[model samples]
Target: MNGAANIDQGLGVSIDLRATPKPGSFYRGKRHAGLIDVDQKGAFPVSQYWEPIYHDDTNEIILDPDEFYILASREAVTIPASHAAEMVPFNPLVGEFRCIMRAFSTRLWHE
Candidate 1:
């Protein structure tokens, strides 16, 4: 599903991805592992790395499925006054996905 909604100034944009029934495995150097990277210089201190996951039950390490993952840009971006930008996802996984892009004084959010 693709659509657009107005985002008011001073309010942050929010996005939610539907949970998969069976989460896939997330591991570096493994087949079907989810990988992400930021093109903006200095956006990510570490150019490449595995994404972090939080354990919901015992607070122990829980491997997230490879079906989906989230990544954020390390570089902070400032939107000049009177200017707006739109974020569009290229070649994303199929089946009902949404991408939200907002301007921050010095940051970019991706999931």
Candidate 2:
């Protein structure tokens, strides 16, 4: 899903909030969203999007100048056969927080 017009390629802004404690606040199914641009070339307008996380349970909270509020998922999902997914945590220097991808099932696909 990589695109030249993608926001990530326009702002040079990277988010690293994993250091912040998780399950900190008890939210009753509230969603939070924001936007980021990575190009910084001044060629595109502010690229924005909504990132809503389901807040239900309570967990430890970490307060840091570089930390952002923790979020949780609301609904559970299941993948059907011939398809799979991966949940990779965000590494500011490497990937995005909500990065998701399809996984291949070698044996099942061959069978």
lDDT of 1 by residue, 88-108 (tens): 443455333223332321242
Scored by Cα lDDT, where does model 1 land? 0.35
Could you estimate the TM-score for every candidate?
0.24, 0.20
Residue 90 Cα positional deviation in candidate 2, in Å, after optimal superposition: 0.9
Worst 10 residues of 2 by lDDT: 102-111
* lDDT of every predicted structure (CA atoms): 0.35, 0.32
Clashes of each: 9, 9
Model 2 / residue 77 / CA error / Å: 1.2
Candidate 2 lDDT, 1-111, residue by residue in tens: 354333333223232343342332111212343332433333332112222233224433333333233343333344557854454454667534442211211111111
